[model samples]
Target: MTSTAKTPLPPAACATALDPTAEPFYLQVLQALDAAGVPYVVGGAFALAGLTGVERPTKDLDLFVRRADFDRLDAVLGDAGLRSELTFPHWLGKVYKGAFFIDFIFASANGLNPVDDGWFERAGRATILGHPVRTMSAEDMLWSKAFIMERERYDGADVAHVLRGCGAALDWHHLMDRAGPHWRVLLSHLVLFGYVYPDERDRIPAWVMHELLRKLHDEMLAPPPASGRIQGTLLSREQYLADLRHGAGDARLKPAGTMSAEEIAAWTAAIGEPHEK
Candidate 1:
């Protein structure tokens, strides 16, 4: 669908600005990514805000890139005067720029790789800070949040908000098809989040949380198991936390050289050039 397609907004999204300061910075980064020809689909809080029309102040920008292009991505960011803060050697993803705190996720270490290529292809277009950019599909955004919520990495309420707001706009069949095998996990998340009361959990409404839960139980779980393909391995949460602490002093985390006026101009000129064939 086109970017301008009328999609339902998330509930509890503020009509007024939530974080004016952070939004502008995010837009700049989006523009930088586009100019550098770096393909990305916006994720996390900013994406939640974009879909719901609610402004959620977030500290960093999250983007998804293919696994093969890490070095190319580093060069693109370098051209734009940003630098990697941490490269998870075991994980292909890296954290870039401390001040802005951008995280470039190559692929989920979890078994969510099926969504990767599709997300990049179907990314909806949007205007952030007056710059035209691509964003994750509302369905994909909800799935991402649902995945995180299931894993207990995020608050259940946040996932609920995203679901309630964007639920109406999602393509149920498409979501069910992609989320088919993970229905149990998704239902478990809904139960954990209190989106559905225990007795009433089986009845999914057209609403966001309910549909997601129902889709998980009804569609995803009904299918027979296929041969699963493992993606990259994931570090345990404890291991990841420890690595973050250990990498605290690494200067590689520091931002690369600041962009001079001339460099900024050149970088802007280079925006929209394709990064990969």
Candidate 2:
């Protein structure tokens, strides 16, 4: 296991610059993960706040670990009294401390991107809950947050906030690669980010925009890839289920481009409730 060591936090009497009076339980959780030698990158609201200085009330801590490390994590944390469950097998796992919990995420709900060691390489250092931790990269955060278009939990705004904060500091090339087949999704967010923060538009590299725009232009000029393929689900898993199920089953709909029926079912099941379109 690759150790994710950072400068140890000072004693509890000292107030860290990030979050003073951090919850002791959260600190315990971080300590356990670290002591167990779990390689994880802190993510979610804590990470966003740490990196972008955007403080939001987060319900729980999010620990982003590689899928390959999950079993090891389970092995180590279980002895520390943190009960874990593969709650959402495709993308999420959970470590519970009674009412409070930590989210252990390895993949996107869409099953497109998975966490790897590269995530740690680009990670920033932070003192979360008064414990030294690695923060997820802005590029990976953008890629992960790009897919969250649910009715109740739209993360487009968060994506824009990251761009506003990281902007020129972001690794555009790596981000572009992370966007992959979903480059259009990234382009949409970047366009909207420009709209949301007009003055910061130049923060994004001109070449990045040019590449995305060129791709968009080519896509527009090109004929449809196939007939009857419902691309709607790619945007939102819940929004296009009707189109995928009841709408004319278009043979040309490339299952590879978007979530297949099985993936959709698993995602829906994983959430433990029906999603609002």
Over 1-277, each residue of candidate 1 has an lDDT whose tens digit, in order, gives: 2222334443433222325556655665667667777777766665667666656556556677765666777776677776663344222354444444566765443324433578877787765566666777767766665544323245455555555566545576776676664655555555654444343332234354667655656665577544232111121222233344443221112132122334323433443444200
Best of the candidates, TM-score? 2
RMSD of 1: 12.8
Supply candidate 2's per-residue lDDT for 260.
Answer: 56
Q: What's model 2's lDDT at 192?
A: 92
Once superposed on the true structure, which residue ranges of model 2 sit more than 4 Å away at CA? Answer: 1-22, 247-263, 270-277
Candidate 1 local lDDT, residue 225: 42
Reference-based TM-score of each model: 0.59, 0.83
Question: What lDDT score goes with residue 13 in model 1?
Answer: 30
The backbone clash count of each candidate, in order, is 8, 1
